[model samples]
Target: MATEPIAEDLAGICVDSHGSAIGMPQLCADWIPNQVFWLVIALVVTFFVLSRIALPRIASVLAERHGTITNDIAAAEELKRQAADAEKAYEKALADARAEAQAISQKTRDEIKAQLDEAVEAADAQIAAKTAESEKAIADIRASALENVELVAKDTAGAIVAALGGSADAATISAAVGNRMKG
Candidate 1:
């Protein structure tokens, strides 16, 4: 008597008199409205949770990531620009340094050339003076040697004449020696 009402209620909902389900529970017409109502409630709750909580959090994270990426890209571009500028400056400086070095080298070469020219000129002047001095000395030596030779010849002639038992005149011997030397 106590279980009879419970069995009747269960039979009308999803079970037969023996307590087995009447058909597929999902397709049962008696349960369709309740299932549909609860399904709609669950879907609404899920939609609200995603829209109000999960989606916003996901959107914030995505936005933050996008902002970070954008900032990194901008910074990279700025650094690239700076690097290019620095390279240009470095190249300019290198060119200027090379030019300055060439100028300095040329100036140094010019100074050395000038000094060398002056030294060469001084050496040439000294050589010319020494050559003139040497020529003058040679002329003096030749004059003295000629005078000594003339005296020796004259003396020899006088001795030869005396040895031959003939009187020799100094003036005549000198005159004869001078005439022979003229040729």
Candidate 2:
């Protein structure tokens, strides 16, 4: 059986054509330090950029949002104040209307009272006039009755004297009148 000869270069250091070592297991072991250094530099750069640029912009935006919130709160408070003022105005108007209604009611009551008083006065005057007229009529009737009584007495005395065949004297006429009055 035939086997191929091993090359010496496989176990020895390999070099590039420019005389630079191309492969070193030791250099490959040191690559971890270089990668660590570059990672630290990248982290620092990222931190500076965020602090100087992006962070400031974000802070400004947040401040603007806070200002907007404050302004909105102030506007809401103003609106609340306006609403309260409107309610107060409405209450005042309602009170005024009630007062006016009360005044009107009082005036109407006063007018009614005045009218009632006037009517009462008129009724009293009419009653007084009617009473006076009744009294006057009663007096006249009494006078007429007295005159009729006197005439009747005279007639009775004349009849009595004719029946008895004697002359009627003043004394007899007066006695007849006295008897009629007693009856």
Candidate 3:
């Protein structure tokens, strides 16, 4: 019975006379063509799956990312331009405000100076009027004092002549008093 042929199954090909494995089954010549055929089928299936499904999805995702980056850069440039314009406008407005402020200050100063000048002129006019009035009053007082002194002197002289019993004329006493006053 030991010499009779053993029935062969898929697992029996690599066995020896005592049913022990010979070397490695994957390296056996009998199974090499079957392994190579299955490897080619697996590689073809993997390539089709990547090309039809996985590769297209990855490419679309990369394209979307690139478009987003480009749009973001464009938006940033536009904002930068707008910022520069706004800065220019702000500077111009600030300069205009400064000029307007200076103009207003100058105008106010001129108006104040004009009002001060008018006030000074009015005060000078009032002082001049007061001075003229005071001079006229002094002149009037001096004239009245002189007339009073002359009257008193004439009365006193007439009294002295009467006391001495000289009988002086009124016209002669008046003429003498007038000559002394002229000197």
Candidate 4:
């Protein structure tokens, strides 16, 4: 029962469509001239606005943006050039500093070497003097020891001869002592 009444209402809607607007208004033959005139007016007005106002403004904005990009690129290139120059200067300064450092190091080394040589020479001179003094003192001590040995030997020999009831002459003892001291 519900489907039958709905079907009747849908059929009545189609039959009553002739008394009301149903299809697209623009496709009607009775309104063709008026729609054409309004469409042409709208198209002409849109074209005029886009070409004279909106398009020119948009074009100017694009040109300004392009100019800004070009300027930025040029500025970047200039900065790069400046950076390269700074790097070169830095390298040169570093090289110069290194050279100066090397020169100073060499000078310092030479001075140290000269001082070392002078000190070595002074030390050697002092050693030579001390060695000569030591040699002279040793020679004097050996001579004094030899003289004391000779005197002690003579005294002992004289004492032994006297105890044995035989007299040994000083000259004879002296000759024997000299012969033995030769070794």
Q: Candidate 4 on 1-183: residue-level lDDT in tens?
A: 433344434334332333434455545565668788999999999999999999999999999999999999999999999999999999999999999999999999999999999999999999999999999999999999989999998888888888999988999988888888886
Q: Answer with 1 or 4, whichever has the higher TM-score.
A: 1
How far out, in Å, is residue 113 in model 3? 0.2
Model 3 sits at a Cα RMSD from the real structure of: 4.4
lDDT of 1 by residue, 78-182 (tens): 999999999999999999999999999999999999999999999999999999999999999999999999999899988988999998689999998899988
Rank candidates, lDDT, best first: 1, 3, 4, 2
Residue 159 error, candidate 2, Å: 3.3
What's each prediction's TM-score?
0.79, 0.62, 0.77, 0.58
Q: How accurate is candidate 1 locally (lDDT)?
A: 0.92
| Alpha-carbon runs more than 4 Å astray in model 4 | 1-59, 166-176, 179-183
lDDT of each: 0.92, 0.83, 0.89, 0.85
Q: Candidate 2 — which pairs collide?
A: none
lDDT for each residue of candidate 2 in 1-183, tens digit (9 for 90 to 100):
124443545324544434446677456543668788999999999999999999999999999999999999999999999999999999999999999999999999999999999999999999999999999999899988887877776777777877899887777787778787868
Off by over 4 Å in 1: 1-6, 24-33
Predicted structure 2, TM vs. truth: 0.62
Q: Count backbone clashes in candidate 1.
A: 0
Better of 1 and 3 by TM-score: 1
Per residue, candidate 3 scores C-alpha lDDT tens digits across 29-86 of: 7888988999999999999999999999999999999999999999999999999999
